[model samples]
Target: MTAGTRGEMDEAPQQLPGWAIPPSEGFTAADLDRLPVPAHTQLIDGGLVFRSPQSAFHTCASYLIVEGLRRHLPGHLRVRREMSVILGLRQRPEPDVCVIRAEADRAPDQTAYEASDVLLVVEVVSPDSEERDRKRKPQLYAEAGIAHFWRIENQSGRPTVYVYELDPATTSYALTGIHHDRLKLSVPFEIDIDLTEIDAL
Candidate 1:
């Protein structure tokens, strides 16, 4: 793997779980745009990721934050779900949610979105994704110099939102705050979203 100016690590060969099959090799960004819409589908680092259909609870929680961000964020910020984020060389991941600075060329065919363009990324934790969302993905984001990252854990009866901001000194993210009540995410956006609405979902 070629490291960019950011000092990225080589992607270690991953051992897939029994249920997680290896992705087709040589998959490119164009292939991602052409894939048929499937239930609970996403692209991880250019490989297809398929999850079981989201439970009613999961859908509600996901929709809650997605809609809230759309409704409240500043007009100069863009909010999207399942949008492919092009990580140079190593991968392109479709995070559960992403907030980016507004751009004139917001097209599906765009091959890359630089780290400087991204403002925040959010992932909703599922049983199968705990290790990745909690341990692995954050490291990748930090190395890419993404400014903010959040992991929303709802594996239990109640949900928790873990908020993190990048720490430049260590090239890692630092926990800013975690909230189980009404959440106020004031970042690239000028508005506040009450995550309690997510529980309603």
Candidate 2:
């Protein structure tokens, strides 16, 4: 038996021991939940993708974004961190942050948030996650009909947020604004975020 990286098993699917079943056919969210793996694993296109451990900087940035949203959003809207959002049958991804509608009818035991319940999805770009955050997730989120998407990028040691709003007619995102130090938005609600505090951490 060979040990893999810290969070993932190194053995190829077919090479796994007798006790381990290969997801050759494909994997579902339920399959991922049952597997003996660490946290932060996601299913994309029926395949398992284990995320790399987040750095201190990444964690701090994520926390700052969540805090900013929570402080400004109305009481009816809720913000969550690292919540799993089910995009479709084959995709379940956990974004860095999510803004969702508060509903009395929502099941208390629901395993994952439905795409329809999400008002916005936020991704903090780490060096290893730039492509997925910038390209892949945006496409998937837009297609799933999530109304808003925010991507936070670290440039020269400062965080800059790029905001996008979905275009229903095209099912794509239109760049609404790029913000540094402060973020102000009028859609879904009116709010402003001061980013300077994030840099101090």
Candidate 3:
């Protein structure tokens, strides 16, 4: 209301780009679609998280898992790669691979699936996302009640799969096994994949 106040406002620095600012309460699941986020953008705890460029190891491991899973999936399940799963209003994460209920694939235009619709979510570890791939994400996925999860670590350029199952009583994941060289699992359906398959990539 005062001339001095108006002059100060005019002299102030210009505002930052809208995307550069973090909302007080962070972004919502819907913001992922409404905003001009880059490819593979994720919403974590209401914060926007962008993905780092993929490494050869990441690409190879993802391919091996996606194809391997697809081969063994029951008719009721479908395999999708790098798809977003909506865990909550503030949590929309794009797992490296998701084995979802076949019914969840309602249309080719669908951008995401509800957490409940996902039977398994696999995250192949990356240098930039170690913490998330190892900890934060699995926690959210468990809380969202995804039945099975696998965290693939790059061990000496080979994919090492760490599988987990959700423990509903505690709302957390219980590590079931650490697989190397070969991955064999029966839950969520039977599948045997030679981890060395990545070597072909």
Q: Against the true structure, whose lDDT is highest?
A: 3
Local error of candidate 3 at 51, Å?
1.2
lDDT of 2 by residue, 1-201 (tens): 435463366444656543244467677766656677557777777777778988876787788888888888888889888778889877888899999988722776665788998999999999888888999989999999999999998877677999999999999999999999888888868878887777677
TM-score of 2: 0.85
Pitting candidate 1 against candidate 3, the one with the higher lDDT is 3
Clashes of each: 1, 0, 0
Ranking by TM-score: 3, 2, 1
- In candidate 1, position 104 carries an lDDT of 26
Relative to the true structure, candidate 2 has a C-alpha RMSD (angstroms) of: 5.4
Best by TM-score: 3
Flag regions of model 2 displaced more than 4 Å: 1-22, 104-110
The parts of candidate 3 lying over 4 Å away from their true place are: 1-16
Candidate 1 to truth, TM = 0.73
Cα deviation of 65, candidate 3, in Å:
0.5
TM for candidate 3 is: 0.90
Error of 2 at 98 (Å): 0.2
How do the residues 130-178 of candidate 1 rate in per-residue lDDT, one tens digit apiece? 7778987788888888898988888455557788999999989999888
At residue 60, candidate 1 shows an lDDT of 70
Q: Provide TM-scores for the models.
A: 0.73, 0.85, 0.90
